[model samples]
Target: METTPAPAAPARRRRSRAPFPVTVTQMPMATCQVCGRALAHRKGEVSAILTAHYERDHPELLGR
Candidate 1:
């Protein structure tokens, strides 16, 4: 009697990879807490900017 051929092995499934995208973020800006107004410069700004702001708005606090 003739014998039947064996069955072939099953194919392996491919795995999917996760995709990554580039992202950008903004930095916090400097602001005055006294009047709750935005500052002209960013964080770590020069003292002159602060002095000018105070002299202009809070001159009384400066005590000339």
Candidate 2:
């Protein structure tokens, strides 16, 4: 006698929601004019820290 084959399982249904892309904004940081290093500041705004850094790092360039 011939045997019958079993039926295959149904495919699963997935959610229709699509994934969203994320974006980020980067602000530029201030750099020290004397040593060419990044200066410490907040919200992309420079303060007296740059001046103090220049005076302490390169006082010879201040007079020129």
Candidate 3:
């Protein structure tokens, strides 16, 4: 009697799906109700580099 070995199966390759489209909605400008002035509000920003240097080097100026 003779024995035979089976062939190995091929590996599958996965493909990524396409990204969704992005659309930006425009917001209207705000106006001040009092004093009849065009109002613009800016959210606060902080810099770690500047704050660290100022606090470390100029501790005296902070109190004054």
TM-score for all predictions? 0.45, 0.43, 0.26
Show model 2 residue runs off by greater than 4 Å: 1-28, 43-45
RMSD of each: 15.8, 11.1, 14.9
The 10-residue segment with the lowest total lDDT in model 3: 37-46
Give the residue spans of candidate 3 off by over 4 A. 1-46
State the lDDT of candidate 1 residue by residue for 1-64, as single tens digits: 9999999889988769766887865545557768977765655664667788889999888896
lDDT of 3 by residue, 1-64 (tens): 9978788888887768777899976433344333244333333322443444456666666673
TM-score of predicted model 1?
0.45
Clashing pairs in 1: none
Top TM-score prediction, candidate number: 1
Clashes of each: 0, 0, 0
Report the error of model 2 at residue 48, Å: 0.5
Question: Can you write out model 2's per-residue Cα lDDT over 13-47, one digit (the tens) per residue?
Answer: 99798879888666557887656898656673566
Quality of model 3 by C-alpha lDDT: 0.50
Candidate 1 segments whose C-alpha is farther than 4 A from its true place: 1-28, 42-44
Ordered by TM-score, highest first, the candidates read: 1, 2, 3
Instruction: Please name the candidate that would achieve the greatest lDDT relative to the true structure.
Output: 1
